[model samples]
Target chain A: MSAVAYYLESAGIATTGISLVRENTKALRPPRFLWVTFPLGRPLGLPGDAAFQRRVVLAALALLDAPSGPVLEDYPEDVPDLPGDDVFACPVRFPPRASGRGRWGSALLEEIALLRPWYALSRERRGRTTVGVAGTLVETLAERLGALLDAPERLPGTLAELTELKRTLADLRAFHEEAVTAQPGDPPWREVRRLLWRESVLGDAMLTLRDRFDASGDPRLRAFTRVLVPRGALED
Target chain B: MVRLSDLPDYEREHLLDKNLGPLGPPAWVPPGTPLRERRVALVTTAGLHRRSDSAFDLTDASYRVLPGDLGAADLVMSHSSVNFDRSGFAEDVNLVFPIDRFRELAEDDVIGGLASNHFSFMGAGLLPEAYEASARDLARILHRDGVDTAFLTPV
Candidate 1:
C-alpha cells in the first residue's frame, strides 16, 4: 500500500492513505499516511458502523491538504470496543497430542469436524469451495504435516525446504478456512482470522517449529520464522 | 478504545521494519489547490473486487478497476493476509472500501466529485515492481478520469 501510494504520488496524483500496519507505513514513509489501530482486514473498523467508517475515510482524505512531503499522522480516536471484550471464545481450540510434541493430530481431526457443517453450508451457497487448492484431502494434509512434525531433525534447513514448509502451511490454512467460510449469520471475518491465527492446532504446531528454527542462528530461518510464525503475538 | 499500546512490541517492530528495506524517496506532488476543488478517487489495498471480476490471487500484484458508482453489494474481499479476522469485512464492504462514504462526501461537495472509476489490489507482501506498474496504470485511470487527489486505504 505504501508502494501504491508512492506510485500514485509519483504520477502527479496527490495521495493520502489509511494504514492498518503502522510499521509498514512508517517504513515506506509514503507522502501522506494515517496510521489507524483498526484490525487488519477491516481498516475502517467494525462492520455496520458507517459513521465510524466515514470518519476514518475523512481522516485519511484530510491528509491530502498537507503542504509538505512525507506526512505521517496517527488517527486520534481509538476504535470503539467490540460488543464482547477479547475473551476469544471459540470451538476450535487445538489440544496437543499425548506426546506433547506439538503434534495435534486428533485436534486437526476435531477442527475438520467442527468446520464440516459450515463448509457444507458455504458450498451450498456458493456452489464451490476454497479448499482443495493443494489437490489433497484434509486427512492427507494432516498426515503429511504429522510426518514433518514427527521428525524435528528433518525440519526445513535450506531455502527451498523453508519455502516448501511455508507452502504446506498455506495449504493448511486455505483448506481449513475455505472448509468453513463463516455462514451468513456467523461471526465476523476478522474474528475467524484472529481465532485461526491465535489458536489453530496446526498454527500452534507450526509456531513450535518456528521457535525451533529461530534458534538455529540461520538468517533465512529467522526470517522465515517471522513469516510463518510471529514472535507469538496476534497482531493487526 | 483502540490504542497503539494495545499492539505488542514485536508486532510494532514487525510493522516498522517489514524487511522490504527503505522504500527510497517518493516523488512529492504538493496539493496545488484547495482539495474541495479537485477531482478525487478512492482506492484500496484490501483485495476487493467486484462479484463479476475474478478474485485476486493471494500474491497477485495486479489491480482491478472498480466503478465509483458500483453497488457495495457487488464488491467482495478475497484477501490472503493472515493478520486480521475478515468476518467484519465479509459482512460489511465499507470496512475497507468506503465507496458509500466517498459518495456521500461527493454528494455534500466536501472535497470534490469522485473519479469515474476506483481501484483495488490484493496487497500483502506485494511485489514492488508489479504494484509500481499497477500504480502507473492507476495514474492513467486518474488522468483519464481527471482526478487530482486519490484516497487509499490499506487493509
Candidate 2:
C-alpha cells in the first residue's frame, strides 16, 4: 500500500514503490516517493514465483539512478492480469501470553473507554460492530443520569422502583461481561447493549446518592457538599 | 563444496577470505590499490519497503534496488510485529542497510567513500532467476559507478 511506502520514506529509508493502481499512488503525499503502475498487492510480482519478484525488486532499485527525480515508471501496460493463488490463506498464530489473558482483556478496556465521548470517537473509527452497540448503551446511561441529576424532586420514593433499577443494572453488567468475552463471529452488538444496561445502574446509584445528600442538608453533609459541588450547583 | 566453518581459524582472519573461496588466490586488485579505500555498497533483503509501493509477495525470494535517501525518524516499518527500535537495526535501516556503517568506516579512513545509493528487497520470493538478473543488473551498475566491492545482507 502507498501508506506503507509513505511511512518507510518518512523513516528515511530510500525507497521507490511500484504499483499498478494509479489512484493509490496519486493519493500519497510528497517526500515519501513511489513509482506507480504496478498491479495491486504484488509489488514484487506473483507469489511463490522467484524470478518475477527479483526482476521487480531490481527495477525498483534501478530507479535510484534516475537523476534524483521522482517519477512513475509504468511497466508494459499490456501485461495481462495473471490470476495467482490465494496467498493469505495461511493463518498466523500468536504465542500465548504468560498472564493467560487474551485479546479479551484489551477489548474490555476499549469498551470502558468507549463510555466517554472522546474515547467513543476512537471506538467508532475502529468500525467494529460490538463497539457501536456498546457506545449506544453508554449514551443511554449518560442520558438517564443527566435527567436524574437535573431533577432530584422526581426521585423514586419506593423500594420497588429502586430494586427494578438495580436489577436492570445487574443484567447490564452480565451483558457487558459477555460482550467482552465473545470471540470472533459472536454477535457483538447485542453483547454491548447488555453491558451498557449494567453500567447505567451504577450511574443511577451515584446520582441517587448525590440527590440524597442534597436533600438531607445535614451540617457535615452540607459542608462536604460545599467542597464537592461547585458554587453554581449550590445556587441552583 | 567447502563449508566456510570447516576452514581452519588461521585462514579465516580476513573478511574477504571469509567471503571468497579460501583455497583460491584472492581476486586481483591493482598494485597500490587501497582495500580500505574501495567504494563499498550494500544490499538487503529485509523487506524494507515503502508503503506506497506494491507489496513484495514471494516467499523466500527477494529483489534488490538502490534506496532513496532515508533516516531513522522517517522509517515506517511493517514486516514482523516486533518493535523496530529493539531490533537495533535503526542506524543500519536508517542509512539504507548499513551502508552508513560502511560510510562511517570510510570516514574513519578505514574504507573509501560509499556508493551514492544502496539496494534493498523483501526477502520472500522463492525463485532465483529474477534475483540473479537483478544482481547482474546491480553488478553492472556498480561497475558503471566504479564500485570496488559490495556487501549483500539477506533478510
Best by TM-score: 1
Quote the TM-score that chain A achieves in each candidate.
0.68, 0.29
Interface RMSD (one decimal) of model 2: 22.9
Residue lDDT tens for model 1, B59-83: 6788888987787556655555556
lDDT of each: 0.68, 0.37
- Candidate 1 chain B least-lDDT 10 residues: B14-23
Compared with the true structure, what per-residue lDDT tens digits does model 2 show for residues A118-146?
Answer: 33332343222222212236435434433
Candidate 2: list runs displaced more than 4 Å: A1-236, B1-32, B60-68, B76-86, B90-96, B125-130
The residue-by-residue lDDT of candidate 1 on A1-236, one tens digit each, is 88888888888998887877666666677899888877666678767677887788788777777878788898987766554524444534445432464455666666667766766665575454434323557666776777776667766656656545554565577555644444544344455555565766766666666776778777877666655654434543
Estimate the overall C-alpha local distance difference test score of candidate 1: 0.68
Q: How would the docking of model 2 be graded?
A: incorrect
- lDDT by residue for model 2 over B30-52, one digit each (tens)? 22435465666655555554433
For every prediction, compared with the true complex, DockQ reads 0.40, 0.02
Off by over 4 Å in 1: A21-29, A65-71, A85-107, A119-199, A208-222, A234-236, B1-6, B18-41, B47-81, B84-87, B103-134
